[model samples]
Target: MSNIKEDQANFTNGFYLETHKRWEKFSNWIHCICVVTFDLELGQALESIYPPHVTLTKQETLNICYLAFPDSNSGCMGDTNFIVRLQSCPSKAVLSNVHTAYNSKCPPALQINPAYYWGYVYFRQVKDIKLPRGYFQKSVVILSRLPFNNLFTKIISVIAPEYFDNGNLSLEAACYNIDQWPTPVPGLTLSLPLLGSVFQTFIPHQRNSTSLILQLAGLNEVATSSENQIQASVEDLNLFDIFQPVLSHIDMLWELVITAEPLIVMASSPNHCSLMVLALTRIISPLKFCADHRTYFTIHDSDFKQFTNKVHGTPPVILGVTNPFFAKTLHHWPHTVRLGEDYGQYQKYKLKKNGNSKIFDSTPGVYSSYKPFLQKDKTMIKNLISGINTKRPFEVQSALLKKHLLELTHSFMIPLERYIASLMPLLKNISPFRAAPTPLPFNPDDFFAMLETAGPQLTTGIKGDWVGLYKKFFRSPNFNGWFNNRYTELALKLQALQLQALSDADLKLWVQGKPEVEIVDMVLKIKNKIKKCEQHDIPVSHTIKEQLEQRLQDIISSLPDDLKNILQTS
Candidate 1:
């Protein structure tokens, strides 16, 4: 045990030592360039807000004054000087503590009078030890009055200047009153202990492919959770509820980044802002589904007078057509057109029983109810089947279903997308790209895996064969009684399989290696075979039929006793 402990301690010490050495090497190579310098006026303004006494350390104070307002020959000024002042401040601990408080169960009070805020302070360092080659390192500090009116508003003015047209100086003034200062300044120095380390270590280290990849993977995990949560919540929300919290959260996250580094606002290019807005809009857009079913009905009078004009021989009554899954709210049309002329004598008899009839019945002997009623029902069914068959031939059905499902998946992905978009301005200024581009269209493998894992209710007996059912339901033209019956059975089985997959691992194993063929293709092939069989019109030999029946019986008998009973019963 002692040896083990010693070994562990030695390993940890060695690891940290290596890490420290790597950091030192990296830092040594960093050519601390003064990219921007503020004049003494700006330095005085900054000091007035923070006071020279509230600095990271004596060295940091000197660094801020010297680097921020360096004498001539110092290349640093403007944006760079501001960033340096922020970097030199002892505000990390304060900022971090504030962040913690904001996130805590009981948030601490951070009073900032928006009107008193001056401009921001920023500092930059270049990571090129070698002459003439390096990326810039930046830090930003916002100098504002305590007790902010709206935190996000302040951040937008200080960090995201491209969002509005006001000049940086004017925006700063508008964001806060420059004159008001608390008589006794709130004695608070909130800090984030790991803020500097995060910037120095995590951000820069992630410049390499390996670290960046890991960071991206972590982000994906976060995105997945956020997306799923948002999608699951969308159906339960009203329109107002949907955008409000989402927009608010986005605003908050943007502000957090801005407050951390004010230069992030100024450094943001217009293109970056536009891209961020576009990405955000795409992420938040609602998913829409089109309804496809259409229903047409008609009513006729005994006098052969049509209430509505006839198409061919049939009078149209109700025509309810839709795209698919998209349902509209109902609208009522109460007034009847051509009311008195259309009713048959017998039809008028029914109406008179309920209330005093105003119009007299006419053409009492002309109507035959039975034949026409039956014919209309038969025609309705035939028309429905014809419509279904007509639609089946077009590739639109499959495309539409796929499109809708993809939309659903995209909807599920929105929250994560929004979160990432919110981070874009900071990401763009700090890195090469803002955020990951919208993901490519849904992949079959990933989709199937998601269905299996997240949608166990979708599983069926024929694992791969379920794809055929999907095609048939979505793509088939004639959904006749026979087809409907078969389809319903298969759907139920699929649903059962999905449920079993969710809760019963053993059942999931049973349907492995199922085929995934298009159902429409299978149906067409079957139809062709049936047509060929009918054309020949030859009865199967008794011997062949007997053999097939025997084989089927044998297969059924071979099932386990319990399963056999269940199958037989079902």
Candidate 2:
């Protein structure tokens, strides 16, 4: 009788799970949340895998733990958060479409197209005296392709600390809340509530914003940021803490970032490694860095063979590694930054090249350094030192450094931005008949010549051979990305101008002398114009689209009875 009852209970439980468990899948922006904790007998181990049904290979779990934990002298030293950017070979289902509030009654879209999953992992750790070793070390990792570190970290920031004291209940609740969020469509800023706190994320409609920022809405705040306001990121990238140690060498580093040089940053721990990598990637603002960079990388990652092959040398990857093994392997690379403990020290890098292999027994300090085009402000350095001596809050000290860097980057970019504007054709050249007016040619010679007359050195407050700097920069990936974006933006603007003019003019006037075939072709072009504007998310395009669409129908209606059938076919 007991056996029969047990079988009956099992059947009921299985039936409910099969029908009602769809809601328990991973979050939309998040792939999976995992708990990697220290096991007494097994050492580092994965304590729990969320969703209860997901399976991970033994090797994958081991690597997750290795990446989740920081390699420092004092293990589980303090509560901290850092990203672990890894290349993973996940199962097909793991990389499925983003989860929504799953409805069992509703069939999912028949297509099961698997998107490539890039692991944007959030690692958090804490300690508890009540645990086995007086140190409760664990990492809560969320795997996803979205590089919205500022957003996801905030969620894990709450979830991890709570889970350390409480248990899986908080984690489950947060996951449930995230799973219910809207599809995160572009141009929408959704106010997501997780465990009583409100967070905001702006899925930008266009490429106007360079980064994704998650804002935590304070309940007692007098007001919230208006939805229209687009702030790049609420959290400062990596804080000012990383820049203080290498204040003197900052100018050279900025040059390296802009030039897209392959550099390695080896630090004592994962926190410093990841933080420094993030900070370096953002030094040049307005002009986004185009090179590949890893925030935190380990030897056990799937990309290990790709990154470490001696025959290939090193690709142009700005890597942040904690393993000392990279010292020998990557010695052949162009530049290597050796960061001291707590990021307290840094050294200039130089390369002694012999067919791009480590030919000489030299310390990692041999990269070609460039002098700053703009003079360094000694006063700020003095103030920073004074702050450190007087025990100023890290926030205050960091802000000062960030301000200086921001100013420095802007000064460098002003000359470029000004020169780029001069490349645009005059407004009088634009016409309604053309699909889009092209910008004037980007002649390197003309630009260099204009720099002198443009008062570039004076306008930018950057002294030196401005021409030489431009020559070097124009060849770089950083400059390429900026130049492309500038031209593309200008082109889109021209397209919009043409559409705007078309909206005002009578379509019948333009089509009077045109053939039916020509009119049909014109209609197709107009359709494409609307689609392009929609893709680019031009605010005025919607109005113009309706106008063009209506005018097309009117032209068709006015056509003679014979051509009307042909127009209808079109």
Candidate 3:
């Protein structure tokens, strides 16, 4: 116990020289870097700082420490990496995909405006006999608003172990190399650099890899990013990786994730726990589940009360929790998936529903609530099985599963995407003679009619009474958000055209036979339209503003003596 007290006070700072890279550049890639280590005699302590001179506030240091050492028990299997998000005050760092992840009914945690934020950590432990404990525990943490999952993980892999053996000098060199990297843009393959090694990754387009709803409507509302890139991809996010633990019920799980049901994924380790959660979230790519989810949650996480206590609030719609304690604690959660390590049972999982622990305690087997609505591709499953038996490279198997899932997702979105486009008012329909047209009101019945007629052709690979799924999604925040954006975009287009025709071709001619008061009203109306344009970030037409101003002046000069005095005073 005295040694434990001694361990508690043990901490070491790394030594390094400053790099030539600009300070602000370092910040854009990552907010700050932290290194934490555990002395067997002690618990966890902050060991070093990357930008060595600065000191952290108590709040910041405590937050990092909490996230740094998340595991409740002692178990180290080589090295593991995972992600954590800290509850923070609203910051300026909002990522486009993170924004899209929030559906209108998003949990209060996500709805809070605290912008993009996260902590990507790499934990490693090495045996040390000279200490109070047999092993020395250490972890490297990066605090950043960016969710460059692969990129950050790669950065840690290069820096952490080397810093462990060497010191701050090695860490500084790695940071310098990273500082030279370019800003992330969606849809382009970026060649990232770190310590003389380069890694290439293609940032998936948000439209292709994340929810369809990409923009937020309403000015002074949560702003949406124009970049097409969704969040950074994890190395493994395909069905093979996510559902590998329960391949038999792959289709059913897909339905569950798409519907954004409350789910708990149990795993043996924090890294596996976090990876599974990230993969599940992305597997329903391009559909955007829009539910609040934590990649990895420990029993000690700050939100424990919010999750377990129904009196305060309900739990997140989706969660990935570690620690067997959750077995009893969250037994009441709607769905729980307990995982096994060996590849054999990776396909088998404990799935509990309706708060039934008997079901929870029951032996692992296929737990299908009902047959999947989407037609299953038996051939694909056989190939996956064959690949596993033949021991095919994991990448090849994961790729095949990914392609199939994307095909299914695209199939689901196509008819709806096509139908949504049809609702836009025709360009020819715009006229100064009338007010801007409203988007054709969405009629689910009409869409269903079209599906009945052409659904088979549009979704050749997937056949089902997905009408239920689609209807369920209609009540979700994602669908509402998508429709709202489409409506706003189309409405703005209609107004733009009307403004164009009125400024160059309609105003002068339409006012020819109108009264002075009516002309004044017309000018005021166009002015209001310009204001809306500015609010939505649509380019305002100077031609219209100038023409309307000229018209207003003409009316004022021509007004009768009595009316002129009244107008001037008003």
* lDDT, candidates in the order shown: 0.25, 0.62, 0.61
Total backbone clashes of candidate 3, pairs 3 or more residues apart or in separate chains:
7
Clashes of 1: 51
Candidate 1 CA-lDDT value: 0.25
Top-lDDT structure, candidate number: 2
| Per-residue alpha-carbon lDDT of candidate 2 for residues 1-570, written as tens digits (9 for 90 to 100) | 233244334434543465334433334556677888778898768888655556666766777777777764425366767776654554544433332212111111111113333333444444567887876677778765555556666777776776666677666666655655666454455666656566765543334332222121111212355544223332345445677666666766777787777888877677677778877876765456776677777776667788878697767678988777776777667676666654543332343332234333334433433454445556767777788778887766765666566666666677677877877777777776775678876788877676666645563454565566667788877777678867877777777777888777788887888887877777777767777766655546467788977876767766788877876675
Candidate 2 TM-score to native? 0.74
Candidate No. with top TM-score: 2
Candidate 2 colliding pairs:
349-365, 349-366, 349-367, 350-365, 350-366, 350-367, 351-366
Worst 10 residues of 3 by lDDT: 212-221
Tens-digit lDDT string for candidate 3 (173-271): 665555556655544556656555565554444433332222110111122333432222323344465567676566666777776666777666666
TM-score of each: 0.18, 0.74, 0.73
User: Which one wins by TM-score: 1 or 2?
Assistant: 2
Candidate order by decreasing TM-score: 2, 3, 1
- The TM-score that candidate 3 achieves is 0.73
Poorest 10 consecutive residues of model 1 by lDDT? 192-201
